[model samples]
Each structure stands twice: as C-alpha cells, then as structure tokens.
Target: MQIPFIDLKTQYETYKEEINKEVLNVLSSTQFIMGPQVTKLEENLAKYTGAKYAFACSSGTDSLLLALMAIDVQPGDEIITTPFTFIATAETIALLKAKPVFVDIDEATYNIDPKLIEAKITPKTKAIMPVSLYGQTADMDAINAIAKKHNLVVIEDACQSFGAEYKGKKSCNLSTIGCTSFFPSKPLGCYGDGGAVFCNDDALGAKLKSLLNHGQGKRYEHKYIGINGRLDALQAAILNVKMNHFEAECKKRIEVGSRYSKLLEGANVITPTIMSDRNSMYAQYSIRVKNREAMIQKLNDAGVPTAVHYPIPLHLQEALSYLGYKKGDFPISEQIGTEIMSLPMSPFLTESQQDFIVNAIKA
Candidate 1:
C-alpha cells in the first residue's frame, strides 16, 4: 500500500459539500477580493485563537510582513529569530530592509532557544520573531520576559502551529503579534494560499488591517506604505468551512503523534518531544536518525513516503551568506538539518497504515 504524506484529499472528501457551497457562493457574488467571507473568517479566527482581533492576508509570508510593517521595522533594524526554520521566517525581516539576527535552537524542542536570545539583543533590536516549529510553541514565557526587559516586540510565527496551545493559551495569541498560514497543508488550511495576523492591542490590530489593504484608511486613500496582502474571498470561504472542524482535527493529530512515539520506542530514531506545559498540533512528526539517507531509501522502496522539513538552515543558505555566518555558527541547527526526516503524519492516517510504516522503518 502506498502511504501518502499529509492526506488533504481525505479531509476534502469529508467536507466536500460544505466547502463546495462556500466556494460557489463566493463565485456567484464576484467579490473575489475582501468579500464578506474574509470578514467572517477573520472574526471567527480571532474568536478561535482568543485574540482580540485578526486580519487575514494573502499568505503566511505576507502575514509576517504585515506584522513587521505594523511594528515599523526600519532599515538596519534587527529582528532576532531562529535559523533552523523555513526561509520565510528570516526572509520577511530582510525584505523590510531590516536585519535578521540568528539564534540557535533547542535540540529537543527544535524551537528557538530563549537562553541565547539575550546575548543577541542590541540597540537596533526591534522584535523577537520565534517560529513555533513542528506545531509546538517555543519557550514563550522566557522569551517574553527577555523581550519585556529589553522593551522589544514579540512576533510568534505560528504558521505551522495554528491550533496548538502554549501554557493553556493558543499559540498565535501567546505573543504581541502572532502570524499563521492557511497553506494547503497547514494545521488549519484553505484550498489555496491564506494567512492571518492576531493581536490583542486594538491600535495594532487597526494598523494591521490598514496594512493588509495597501495601507488604506479609506478607499483610494493610501496611508502607511503597504502591499496588496489581503486574503482572497474564496480562500477565506474555504477556511471558514475548515475552521468548523479544526478542533476535532487537532485532537486526532495529538493521538497520531502519541501513537507514533509509543510505537517507535526503542527504535533507532529520536521521535519529536512535546513539552508537558504545551500541546502540539503535530504538523509534521519528524524524527532524527543516523544513516538518514539509507532510511529514506528503505522507506521509499517500501512505498512509505517521507519528506524533509528543511535540508539547510537559513544562516548557511547562499542568499544570506552576506550575514557572515560560518559552518559552526549554529551547530545544533546544522546538525538537525542533516539528520531530521519527517514521517507521513495526518489525522486521517489509519492504524494499519501507521503499523506498516513503522514496521518498514524497523526493517
């Protein structure tokens, strides 16, 4: 049997009728951009995440951009972030003509290490953007304490962790400004590209709304310099339907992750670690293994598909070489880049399929 990674097809089939109706409604209205569906989704997202306000945008990357713009990130302004995450985490900071200061990650959690952040702070520091890697939030309490001491802003990159919880609070609402993606495979996703920024501050929420619409306070009136980052009505409509079942899906994901850990015990691999203080959505059940390439080949031959969350850390990527980082700069990130491999993980994955995959790994 061919086991697929991230089975969105099963989810689509489950909600076909509702999703189809919503899409058709948007098409009939011809309000493809910022339609009523977008407003409704934004409101629902805010309520779901416990944020006072939410602004839907074109993609997760743009959500980060909007957060930076609202926080007034200027040229040479430094935003402290992790190098082990997707490039978009650092790319957004650089796009605003600001610098992204790299921080090492915790080996077990794979999230930014709060202990290393204080050393990176400088007079030019503007914000701390910590990615909630693999659906688990970083050490937000420690990071927030550091940020508070420095009077710096905190942006939680919850793109991979939309429905996750940190210390009894939702991941996206754990910081000053939280951004998440609704890309097709995210914990909460739409049919296509979509994202949102959440904030408790009413003034900042208003600023984010203005920035999402080409910086417009009113129609044809441009305010702060912004980009066309509004979420399409069609995508919002899709997300609205998906949001209805998100909580149930999250519960299933936790079960899948827990089972994987139990089944893989004593196996020659390191399963992901979820802290007791927080619950993960288990966006990707990644593992660290020796002889990763050979293991990947074995899984492929067995028809159990796999993927790598990242093969290279951003600090070592050629694009950011000018940042002057070298091989040993972030040893943990560099090591994980070579060893980490993601197994097929989804709420829809069946017990039989999981057993097959695990048995193949042991082979």
Candidate 2:
C-alpha cells in the first residue's frame, strides 16, 4: 500500500461540495479581486486568532514584508530572528535593506532562544521575529519581555502554527505583529498562495491595511510606499469555508501528532516535543534521526513518502551569504538541519496508514 504525505486530495474529496460551491459563488459574482468574501474572511480570522485586526496578503512572504513596512523598519536596522526558520523570515528584513541578526535556537522547541536575544540587540535592532517552527509557538512571553525591555517590535512568523495556541492565546495574536501562510500544504490552506497579517495595535493594524493596498489610505491616495499585497477574493472565499471546520481539524491534528509520538516512543527517533504551555497544529510531524537520508530511502522503498521541512538553515544559504555567517555560528541549527525528517501527516490520515508508516520506520 502506498502512503501519501499530506493527503490534500483526500481532504478535498471530503469537503468537495462545500469547497466547490464557494468557488462557484466567486465565479458567479465575478468579484474576483477584493470582494465581500475578503472582508468576511479578515473578520473571521481576527475573531478566530483573537487578534484585534487581520489583513490578508498575496503570500506569506508578502505578509512578512508588509509587517516590516508597517512597523517602519528602516535601512541598516536589525531584526533579530532564529537561523533555523524558512528564508522568508529573514529574507524580508534583507529586502528592506535592514540586517537580519541571527540568534541560536532552543534544542527542544527549535525556536529562537529568548535568553540569547539580549546579547544580539543593539541600538539599531528594530524588531524580534521569532518563528513558531513546526506548528509549536516559541516562548513568546520571554521573547516579548525582552522586546519590551528593548522597545523593539515583535513579528511572529506563525506561518506553520496558525491554529496552534500559546499560553491560552492563539499564535498569531501572541506578538506585536504575526504572519501566516495559506500555501496548499499548510494546515489551513487555499488552492494557491495566500497569507495574512494579524495585529492588536490599532495604528499598526491600519498601517498594515494601507501597506497591503499599494499604500493607499483612500482611492488614488498613496499614503506611503507599499506593494500590491492584497489577497485574492477567490482565495478568501475558499478560506472562509475552511474556517468553518478549522477548530475541529486542529484538534484532530493534535491527536494525530500525539499518537505518532506514542507509537515512536523508545524508537531510534527523537519525536517532536510540544511544550506544556502550548499546543501545536502538528504541521509536519518531524522526527530527528541521525541517519536521515538512509531512513528516508528505507521509508520510500516501503512506499512511505517523507520530506524534510528544511534541509538547510537560512544563514548558510547562498542567497544570504553576504551576512557573513559561517557553519559554526549556529551549531544547534546546523546539526538539527542535518537530522530532521518529516513523516506523513494530516488530519485525514487513518490509523492503518499511520501504523504502516510506523512499522516501516521500525523495521
């Protein structure tokens, strides 16, 4: 039997009618741009995440960029972030001509070590952008306390942790500004690229809205330089339908992740550690193994598909070499990058499928 990683097709089959009807409604209305659905989605997202406001953007990259622009990140400014996250987290800072100040990650959570943040901050440090890697939130309270002491902004890269919670609050609403992706493989995804920015600061929220719409405060009025970052109405409509069932889906994801850990216990794998203060959405269900490549090959031979959420940390990438980072700069990130591997994961995965995957790993 063949196992699939992230069974989107099966999920679509389950929700075909609801998803198809929403797409058809968009086509029928022909309001393909900023239609009513977009506003409705933003409202629903804000309510769901408990963020005072939410602004949809074209992609997760744009969501990060818009957050930086809204917070007035300037050239030569520095933004502190983990080196282990996806490049977009640091790429946006570099795009603004601001510097990305790399910090090491905690071993357990694989998130930026808040204790090390103080040493990285300088007068030019403008923000702290911690990623909630693999669906669990960083220690946001500790990160926030440091940011508060330094008077810096905090932009949470919540792309992989949209439905996850931290200390009773949602991931997106736990920081000064939060960004999340709606890529096809994400927990709550659309047919194509999409993302959203969330904020509790009213002024920053309004600024983010303007920045997403070509800096227009009103029609034909350019308030500040911005990008065309608006989310498509079609994507918005699709997301609204997903929102109806997202809570239940998230709960199921937690259950699935727990089962994976329980089954893998005492095996030659290091299962993901979910902090007691928070719950994960289990976006990838990554496991750490010394011989990742061999394990991947063995799993593939058994018809079990696997993937690496990130094979290389951002600091070592060719795109960011100008940052002058060397391999030894972040030993933990480099080491983990070599060992982390993702298994088949989704709310729709069945008990038999999970058993098959686990047995393949053990064998």
Candidate 3:
C-alpha cells in the first residue's frame, strides 16, 4: 500500500463543499485585494488566539519582515534565534541588515535552549525570536523572562504551531509579537501563501497594520517605511472557510498524533516527545533515527514516503556564511539537521495508512 506523507486529498474530501463555496464566492465578488474576507479573518483569528489584534499578510516571511519593520529593526542590531529552524527565521533578521545570533537547541524538544539565551545577549541585541518548531512551542515563559531582563523584543515564529499551546496559553499569545505561516501544508493553511501577525499590545498592533501597508496609518499618508504585505482576499476567504472546522480538525490532529506515537513504540525510530505542560497540534509528526537516509530509502522502496523537516542548519547555509558561523557552533541543531525526518501527518490520515507506514519502517 502506498502511504502519502500528507493526505491533503482526504482533508479536501471532508471539506470539499465548504471550500468550493468559499472560493467561488471570492471569484464572484472579485474584491481580490485586501477585502471583507481578510478583515473578517483577522478579527476571527485575533479572537481565537486571544490576542488584541491580528494582521493578515501575504506570507509568513512577510509577517516576520513586517514585525521587524514595526519594531524598527536596523542594520547591526542583533536578533537571537535557533539554528535548527527554517531559513526564514534567520533570513528575516538578515534581510534588514541585522545580525542573527545563533543559539543551540535543546536535544529533547529540538527547540532553542532558553538557558543559553542570556549569555548571548548584548547591548545590540534588539530581539529574541524563538521558533515553535514542529508544532510544539518552545519554553515561552523562560524565553519571555530572559527577554524582559534584557529589555529585548520577543517574536514567536509560530509558523508550524498556530493551534498549539504551551502551559495554558496559545503559541502566539505568549510573546510580544507572534507570526505564523499559511503555507499550503501547514496545520492552519490556505490554498496558497498566507500568514498573520499576533500581538496584545494595541500600539504595536496598530503599528503593524500600518507597516504591512507601506506605513500608511491613513490612506495617502505614509508614516514610516513599510512593505506591500497584505494578505490576498481570496486566501482570506479560503482561510475563513477552513477556520469553520479548525477546532475539530485540531482535535483530530491530536488524536492522530497520539495514535502514531502509540503504534510506533517499538519501531526503530525515536518518536517525538511532548513537554509536560504543553500540547502540540502535530503539524508534522517527525522522528529521529539512527540512519535517516537509509530509513528514507527503505521507506521509499516500500512506497511509504517520508521527508526531512530540514536538511541543513541555517548558520551553515552559504547565504549566511558572512555571519562567520562554523559547523560546530550549535551541536544539537547540527545533530538534528542530520537525523530528523517527518512522517505522514494530517487530520485526515487513516489508521490503515498509518499502519502501512509503520510496518514498512519496522520491516
């Protein structure tokens, strides 16, 4: 049996009618830029996340860029983040001609080690950006405390963790500024690229709204430098439809993830771990293995597809070489860069398909 890594087909089958109707409504209206749908989505998202405001954007990358712009990120300013995350986490910092201070990740959770954060802070450190890698939030309480002590802004890169919770709080609500992606494969995704920024600070929220629109607080009046980062109206309408079933889908994702952990107990792989006080939305049920490449090859041969969450650490990427980071800088992230592999995970994955995947890996 061929087991797809993510069963988008099954998910679509469940929400076909609603999604189609929403898409058609957008096509018919043709108010295709930032319209009523985007406005409604922002309101709903803010309420759902318990944030004072939410700003929709073209993509998660744009959300981060806009967040940095709102905070006046300048050249030579330092933004500390984990080396184990997607390039966007570091790229956004670098794009503003700022410095990205690489922090090592915790071996168990594969997230930034907060204990190591204080030692990296300096007067030039403008912000601390911690990524919620693989749908599990990093230790936000600890990270926030450190940020407070150093007077640094905190931006939670919640791209893979929109519905996830840490302690009793949601992912985006725990930080000064939170950003999430709506890439097609994400847990809370639209058909195309989309993203949102979350913040409880009213002033910051208003500033973010302006920053995403070329710093225009009012039409034809530009206040500060910004970008054309508005979310597509069609994408917003699509997301609104998706949100109607989001809570239910998140519950199903939890159940599906639990089942995978239970069934893969004896398999030759290191299953993901959940922090005691946290809950993951399981954006991608990733695992660490002895020989990831060989396991990938075996799974491929058996028609059970698998993928790596990331193959290289951001600090080591050629684009960031000017940052002068060497291979041994972050031992844990480098180790993870070599072994982490993601399995099929979605709200609609069937037990039979999951079993086929597990059996293939075990065999």
Residue by residue across 17-107, what tens digits does model 1's lDDT show? 9999999999999999997998899899989989999999999999999999999999999999999999999999999889999999999
What C-alpha lDDT values do all the predictions have?
0.94, 0.93, 0.91
lDDT of 3 by residue, 1-363 (tens): 866677777777788898889888989998898889999999999989999999999999998898888889999999999989899999999999999999999998988999999999989999999999999999999999999988999999999999998888888888899999999899999888999999988889889999898889889899888889999898898899889999998999999998989998987788889999998988889989979889999889888878898889998999999999998988888888899999989898888888888888888
- Whose lDDT is greatest here? 1
Q: Estimate each model's TM-score.
A: 0.99, 0.99, 0.98
Tens-digit lDDT track of model 2 for 1-363: 867799889888988899899999999999998979999999999999988999989999999999999989999999999999888999999999999999999999899999899999999999999999999999999999998998999999999999999989998999899999999889999989999999988899889999999999999999999999999999999999999989989999999999999999988999999999999998889999999999999999999999997889989999999999998999999999999999999999999999999999999
Sort the predicted structures by lDDT, highest score first: 1, 2, 3
What lDDT does candidate 3 reach at residue 261?
90
lDDT of 1: 0.94
Q: Give the runs in model 1 whose Cα sits over 4 Å from its true position.
A: none
After TM-score superposition, what is the CA distance of residue 22 in candidate 1 from its true location, in Å? Answer: 1.0
Model 2 is weakest, by summed lDDT over 10 consecutive residues, at: 1-10
Candidate 2: deviation at residue 121, Å?
Answer: 0.5
Q: What count of clashes does model 1 give? A: 0
